[model samples]
Target: MLYSQYLYQDDKPFKTTIRNYNASDFNQLIDIQKECFPPPFPSDLWWTKDQLANHVHIFPDGAICAEVEGELAGSITTLIADNHGEDHTWEEVTDNGSIGTHDPNGNVLYVVDISVRHKYRKTGMGKLLMQSLYHLVVHLQLEAVLGGSRMPGYEKVKNQMSPQKYFEGIITGEHNDPVVSFLMKAGRSPIKLLPNYLDDPESDDFGVLMEWKNPFLEKRKHFF
Candidate 1:
């Protein structure tokens, strides 16, 4: 079989197109999430049809999806927050929490999640999704974009080791994950690490706080 045939199980060509997400797209969006995340978020957390339709309510105006020939390929969520100063004290209240610190006018873009299908890994779809989010952030005149990177886990090697050891490996790799490469490429800098910050008792997971300033902003300096 040809490469395209093997990948899509059909002879159709691959074409990626991005558009604002709608309520009708929920099931397809959930399917893409399942294909992308190893331990995917529960179905309850997946944005419902009503949620996607109200993009401004759940996220920023440009929150979008990339569909390849009518099939959901990836999705991204963006939002804004107020400047809360130097201390991330509010993080104590939430695991995937986001806050925008030090905005006199209270303007900052927070990218909540970005995911792409497994078969499309390393194909620039991730970057494309990010670029789309960035454009939305810029269009909204946000001060900056903030997000976190999770450490990769044993799903890539689950069959070879005990679950405990697999989690250990994930924690180890989290401290040294190559995510830094992508962040640096996107003009972002690592600000801090929240150790053992998750709500789940069994989760040894931590989070890395990162930020990317808007290069177009004038008189930019330290926020806090």
Candidate 2:
């Protein structure tokens, strides 16, 4: 389905609330994650009484959830690190193998994943979830945020197309994917494409690393 432009707007009147993810919320959060993504994380990874305990002990304040009228609408998990000098830490986590290390001032906020439920998608919940994370970055005095996107793979038909061309078409909205459109509107631009990043030999879907700088910080103003 083509992404609805309205989903990216913040002028809605939804009663969005931000809260720390707790033990009781784990199951609901995982359920929402499964409903939103193609290859969702295993339920064992997120839904358990011990999950919140682990998160709190390891990285307090890294997981956050959004609610609309008491329903679990979306969630984001972040890891803050020292100024890594670059804006693709999330990609690095997926590629280079380090997961929890950060820069000196904790200036880099790597958004591991952000997802919104399918029914609530086009009402700006995704952008709201993202903006909430931005506020978290500012609150923590972070420098930048980064994440990854899946670029569509090439097709070998009667007329084959190159992988690069397939990805370009996807980003340009030729395929009508809303996630790409939303990313572009959120001030995220692609940094690099990691070929075979997903390890699917037949799939040309490369990883597109994207980043967004804190606008308030860029203006030499304090986030607080």
Candidate 3:
């Protein structure tokens, strides 16, 4: 979709548009992944170009990228899942990060990956990516959007706090976790803490399950 309106972050203007992922963006996506997630990066924590291309093949419209002035600023990849009445670890749902388990007919929209280029971060690209997903949720009439958020700055305090306390700290403004804070403001509520969810230690080897309910679903439930 062509996003014409401008959003500013860090006092810089960002004019972005969300579009379906294409074969040409593979290299750029790889670069963004590396930059956003630094060393100690486990192979399973990230998707290779080939794997992402396969995802596009499985569900073309499920993956989206944000472009600013013809440059790929960020991307959000998603898949359909049949997660009902159960909590799933990141690996189980993403098939160890290959996303081979994506089911097109599933009711819940599973967010597989999201990233913003380092230079383009704080430019509101992430929020726009989320808005795009919300739009997809409404258009497709999905139940909700589900994903996991890494506690990026948790390593500094892991020795002194439990994952639960850390999460509460972030929610209560006692700690500043960029990823969690962003997701919280984007309307995704924290479902629970996931232990050993990702191999990357920067996330403190943990992730928080988050969900954004489809407003349409709530409205429909009222009528039924």
Candidate 4:
């Protein structure tokens, strides 16, 4: 329920709050998924009221939203997973978007979804949400945060190279995935490449498992 710092528009400053989204946000949250993920991505995959209700009732801290000038701008949902960072499919991990696999005392924070409205893209809303997540990890003393991110641009190069190679290109700076690359800039790194992770035709059903280590935990163990 703690608020993240304020964000400004490129031309003028506007108040943006990053906090736990409630049941009232359910309608807007569904709308954001459509705005962020257009056709070709299954509409059925969008969150339902029952699923969002589980998120709020089960682990409210992990259900985060970004609001600008009292308007819903974006959202990111997570759960403390039981998978132990395995190379699991998105459905298996997130329990079909209900986050039914949530384990409050678990060490890993598993991000199931993140979306920013098209009008709010490139406005730093996504990054601010991530920054709030980092704080959540530290506050809860979790070991790490993880997510299976789609390689949307892979559709173009699926014929040219393997998904692994496409991922390598992204890491090596030779290629950039509009979505995954931005996540890289937010302090996460791709650790594993998963196949058939989701039914994302835009990604050829490919996903890259990304991770952000809890620096607070790291500092407690290392000499650095």
Candidate 5:
């Protein structure tokens, strides 16, 4: 139900632990979101404390967090979506920015949100969290992991290129948007380029619909 990783730097060991959400993590989640995301994060995207409390209560393992030396460094939240049965945008699944639904039997692991504290951005914490999610996909026997990836560098070239062009550039390595680049390197493929997916200038108000198929899913289903 929980996991941990140890890394060494300067001959010292730092432990990063991944675990399910709890009541006390509410404030830290808020702080991490404020630091990692641009100003005025849509209220619906970041829920109120009471709402998050309810969410964790309903789907305890749906949310996971990473801590380094007992301090919160990153977090990831997921929901089950039946992407194989129908097509739905991030907004529709998230209830127009509010994390309003989670279908446990759905075949897709919908990564509703993921973030790392600003201070730990460049470190490997984010990757560890992602690896944990990948394992989670295997553990749950899901079809794939799906989400809308941000384009942090979009503002710099929004006027110079269209959303599709920008997305292609990133896919082709011509553009170096941090989030999309990271996802691509992690083996996720873009399902489509979404325009105005979120109202963020830093991302040029765009998002890339991304998916990472689970290679073991079919085998697991066959055995089960």
Candidate 6:
């Protein structure tokens, strides 16, 4: 569907490709993490070389990225896990970003990290990545796609409403959030609110659990 209109560079539509990233993409990915999450975001939390390598070796299918002119434009890293339908933090579920718990047989495609470089944002890059994920879900016969989304807009209205209420507001159209709203439009729905999900002051340490269920889930079950 995203046939055109990718991130523009110098007022021209830059050629971009979405594909499974390889080891050569390691350094660019690190730079991308720095560009996406700058100071005060805890330098220790950025993507490490070892962790990125682990992703390529452990679950190459889940580690994907967007590229423009041989350079990374953005990326999405994921792992497979059984859906426990419980509350948990990013670090706890993603094995502290190493994704050592990846299981190909798991029913859920758990998104660990999704970052679009500053300039490449709002340009359908993220949307394309998500679309790719949905296709992967169906291909793997998985139940759904799951991710924890930061509520960056929450901090601005924290005094007026609780995090849960704010998330509900996004769901009910009472509020518009950059991250969660985008995910919603991409076919995901909020499952619950996760408190203290990350060290993010902008989100007030709050996050939203989201899911995009596979439409062919029942068909896959019938076949099995």
- The lDDT values for all models are 0.55, 0.58, 0.79, 0.86, 0.75, 0.84
Better structure of 1 and 2 per lDDT:
2
Per-residue lDDT of candidate 6, residues 21-95 (tens digit): 888999999999999887656778899999999999999988989888777889999999988457788888899
For candidate 4, the 10 contiguous residues with the lowest summed lDDT are: 215-224
Candidate 2 — which residues are off by over 4 angstroms? 1-13, 38-53, 82-99, 102-105, 152-160, 170-175, 199-205, 218-224
Candidate 2 lDDT for residue 62: 67
Can you list the residue pairs that collide in candidate 6? Answer: none
lDDT of 1: 0.55
Q: Between 3 and 6, whose TM-score is larger?
A: 3
Q: What TM-score fits each model?
A: 0.67, 0.70, 0.90, 0.94, 0.88, 0.90
Best by lDDT: 4
Selected candidate, larger lDDT, 1 vs 4: 4
Error of 5 at 73 (Å): 0.4
lDDT of 2 by residue, 1-224 (tens): 00112232255555667777777777887687667644432343233345445554455566778776668888776677644433343345522312335343566676666778887777767776677667777777767776666443332321466655655666776653355557767666656555655432233445565667777765532222
For model 3, how does the per-residue alpha-carbon lDDT over 180-200 read when each residue is reduced to its tens digit?
Answer: 888888788877778877776
Give the C-alpha miss distance for residue 200 in model 5, angstroms: 2.1
TM value for model 4: 0.94
Candidate 2, residue 7: the lDDT equals 38
Model 5, span 149-182: residue lDDT tens: 8887877887898888888898788988889888
Whole-structure CA lDDT of model 5 = 0.75
Itemize residue pairs with steric clashes in candidate 2. 81-102, 81-103, 82-102, 82-103, 82-104, 83-103
What ranges in model 3 sit over 4 Å off? 9-12, 218-224
